[model samples]
Target: MKHGLLWIARALGLFALCSWLTRRELRILCYHGIWDGPGHYGNYLFMSPGKFRSRLAFLQDWGARVLPLPVALERLAQGRLPARAVVITIDDGWASTVAHMVPALEQAGFPATLYVTSYYAHNQRPVLNVALAYALSRWAAGERDSTLLPLPGLGQLNCPAGDAIALHRATDQVIEHASTLADDDARQAFLCSVISATGLAQDPVWGGPAFRLASRDQLREASAKGIDLQLHTHRHRTTCNGTSCLAQELADNRSWLTGVGEGPFEHFCYPSGQYQASDWEVLRRQGIESATTTEIGLCRRGENPYALPRILDGESLSELELEAELSGFLTMLRRISRR
Candidate 1:
């Protein structure tokens, strides 16, 4: 009932009025990675390229005025935002930003910010979560003996070494293993080895070298093509790593990112949306203009720029659901429902 009403309200131009009235704020759309081909299953890091294109079309057809993130923030601060203004921000600089997402955004003429997590860029490994999920998927697809399976650093699981059903029982072990790694490179190596031992693929993940952060060539080329490469952190670590550790990560991130990225790096996205309130002090000290979180809300003026909220856009959010959210009706409903 509520969804239908929201859709009707959007069609009837009610939210259009809201957009006009609320032009002082901005609607920031956050996305992760984009997959090129169909090897990834259950990978929430990105959507398929086809799906991503369709989303851009939806925003255009719905009359959204897409702006680069930094430009949008500046306009909002000046109280000169356009009605129906939206900003595109893709977190985690995967190679797909060059292979798949860039062409699509160029086609739509939409400017986007690609926040690169520097550790993967600095080291020679793919992101850990991708490797972890890949190993689990590989284990689940093959036949093996009925015995306990052991994982390094993440403890042992009673997973049937050769049975899909039994392997399915050990899924949580994969997730826990990925999270406990010392750093991004360590996690990548550990998980990639697991995939190799399982005989998952002859070529291995990211076509072997295609994974990891955007290569220096990719970063240089992307910036030349008008796509913005920004900061996600040197290691995608947040305040959970202690203040000094976090500071080092930022300094390292800015150093390498500026080495390849165009001009100054002023924006940030909390790695995996994990952060503490005191992290703002670190951001301000670094001269960050804005920082986005996984928190759900619209960005209003005078809000803490370091802790701004964003709506996570992914496969889990269907087109209709996205329409409702972008229409800004769902936020209104939540406010009334809470009342």
Candidate 2:
């Protein structure tokens, strides 16, 4: 039904009309990693390099004026935004992104901001949460044995191999426990245990460097190559934990990021799109010029700078869906439905 509607909207020129109407609004595109793993694994967190290249082609063909994030935000405030202005943002600073996405962006001569969550980057490890999710999803059907993987304090991770909710609960428990481990080495050992238990230590997503964050040197190289490195918090968390947690995350994130590049590192993206009313003053006090969320829609003047929206361009989104989104037809439909 939705696909049919989109086709009809295109046929009726609604896409064109919506694009023209929202041409002045700022469209921030959010992306994550580029998947270089063997075979096709459909994950929202990663996409193939070819897909990313095609996305850049789409932006160019659609006549989008890609601007540096900071410049775009400044222009947005001054109402000097060009028609179909777009800001391309990448989250997490994945190794694949630096190896694949950054090169693609540079080849296209487009400016992009990378929101780097410092912990994994500095620690040089696969993100624990992601590793757990992958491990749980791939644990064999009959291998529901809790004793397969054991942690010192977190006991057994007994979970239904097929029940997603149960698996999520188990993952969370282990994650919380992993956080309490002594050090990065301990955490790495824990992850190794998980990989071994799932018998997936040989998988590229688990064993290879693909799932890791870009190292400090690689990030520096990307920065040198013109990718704007920005803050995404030290641990990929937000103010929901409290004002102090948010403050520490920012400070640590800033400390690591500043060591990588030059000055003016001010933009932020909420870790996991979590934010609240009380967050505005905290962010303002911390020198944050703008903060983006995972919220969907075009950003316009007068909207809160601390909670700007973005279009999450990911593996699941098709080209037609991307067109509908960029043209503002999807945003219009969303707004009408909300009313």
Candidate 3:
């Protein structure tokens, strides 16, 4: 019944959009990882390549003009966007993006911008949360038995292999709460406490392999392919307690991007779609011309370029849903202007 209501809402949304979008506006579609099969860590975070391609085709069929990021930004500034203008942006320099999504974009003659996390470009492994998720899922399916691992402060722990789903949920909650910590020390303290309290060291699911990050070579190869590399923060840090910490985060990111020769980077993506007013000020001072947020709206001429909005594209959106997203800008404009 819930699914049925969603379908109904989608249909109604598309109808409203069609009536609203009669002119051209700039629509930016944002994506993260594109995988053939969903990641074991968290399926909701990634979209299948087939769905992504179909979304591209839908935009083309609907008379939307796909432009490069710089071009899109320029037109948006001047309020001279053509009818049905759209820009595609993918976040995270996921390997699947180069292997799967890039080819599709190239074939479609669509230009896109990819935001890369500097830490990942250095080949750092993904956080323990993703590893925990994969391990939990495998354990739940009875695919594995005992696994070994070290928990910070707790030394080593063996995760058991049963009741995988429940274990995964508990681990997820722990990780999510840990993420709210303001700094590395706080995060580490929280994780250590969780590990000590849960006694997960004896569990098989906690001993799985760590997830790998994108390598520098992969990023260079992607750049060679005309994929624009932009900023996504170092360590993917979303928040800091004070201005000094925030400045350090930005500085560290800029330093990494420059050190690796992956920059002249002007665009920034808020980590986890998280940002504060201080974050925006730091971005501006650091020479970032435009920054994207997880906010849901279309880019308009008069909108602040620095706090630009992007639409999240994922498996949940069908072709019709994509249409609604594209046309959503018009609806937003009308609503805002009281037209």
Candidate 4:
């Protein structure tokens, strides 16, 4: 109750301040996945669709002028924006995003920029980590015998063969290696074999569209519905490979986008929000107009286009929390209180 009251007070204070002079900073909101139900199976990267809808409604009801990201950036570049300007961006391609978010967005009449990981969209396979997560969820670590695989730093990691502590460590160890596989096919095959050999029942949802990437049909439909498809690179990691690899990854992402008849990609988002300062040059060279990072702050003019920041909202955030979030008052109080 104290926290709730504090947030409400913060909201009131900001509204009073804004009555005299409005804050013109443009806010970029980032979301990842949207699911109708709770986040499950180590999949906490989702926001409840109902909450997402409510947040949009609140923004619209409060009269925030939501804009497409590219348009918002263009307007901001020109030295102005609508009052309380905001751009909605969802990162990484998830089928639930198309399934649940599209309807919510249409209801709110808001436009969003979706940064899709091209490799997943092109392959239509469950993300290797997500698959690993699902498998790990139901694992009875002592249930079965599978030949142990060499796990790099860990040596001979076993599945359905370790204790509770061992299984936890093994999950991390496996995902790390999966992320390094050269090709998606090899990674998928490796995961499939591991899951099967471990006697783990692959969740039914995994094979269904729920855990897979959005289909080409879905991407085209989202485009028709006013979503901007942007670059998130082919493998979702850029700097891990060299600078040239970064360019090639983006090239692959665009090629996939073009093949689906869905885009003229202009914007980018760093995968896992990981990037180095030097990466800005590579992105600019690729003709990306702007790139957003996981950094948190309102964007302003003269800010580096290649290193823009965003406001993150998720299933756990409530309307009141967002009220305090957008106001900037809550953060201020927290910083002061901390000091």
* Ten contiguous residues minimizing lDDT sum, candidate 3: 204-213
lDDT comparing candidate 3 with the true structure: 0.66
Each candidate structure's count of clashing pairs: 1, 0, 11, 0
**C-alpha lDDT score of every prediction, in listed order:** 0.75, 0.85, 0.66, 0.75
The sequence of per-residue lDDT tens digits that candidate 1 reaches over residues 63-100 is 98999988888888888888778998888888777788
- Model 3 Cα lDDT, one tens digit per residue, 1-339: 644654676566744564356344578889887644424334436777777788778878877788878888887777677877888888867767777777888888888888877765574544545544543354344544345444444343455556555565556654666566687567645544554444544544334312444567766676777778788878777665533455566677777766443568888888788777766777778888888888876776777777888877777765655555677733555566975
Best by TM-score: 2
Model 2 ranges with Cα > 4 A deviation: 40-42, 140-162, 239-243
Pairs clashing within candidate 4: none
Question: In terms of TM-score, how similar is model 3 to the real structure?
Answer: 0.74
Model 2 clash pairs?
A: none
What's the ranking of the predictions by lDDT, best on top?
A: 2, 1, 4, 3
Looking at model 2, report the run of 10 residues with the lowest lDDT sum: 140-149
Off by over 4 Å in 1: 1-21, 39-44, 141-156, 159-189, 196-199, 202-210, 240-244
In model 4, the runs with Cα more than 4 Å from the true position are 1-5, 15-22, 36-44, 137-168, 179-183, 193-202, 241-244, 259-262, 330-339
Tell me which residue pairs clash in candidate 1.
144-162
Q: Name the runs in model 3 displaced over 4 angstroms.
A: 1-24, 37-44, 137-169, 172-210, 241-244, 259-263, 329-339
Q: Give the per-residue lDDT of model 4 (tens digit) for 1-339.
A: 956685667556764463223356678988888654324432237777677778888998767889988889888888877767888998887888888887789878898999988777877887888667656655543344453644333466665443666667778877877877888787887788667644554446545665577988888788888788888998888865344478888998888888553567879999888888878788888889999998776777788999998878866666766666566555455556879
TM-score of every model? 0.85, 0.92, 0.74, 0.82
Deviation in angstroms for 70 in model 3? 1.9
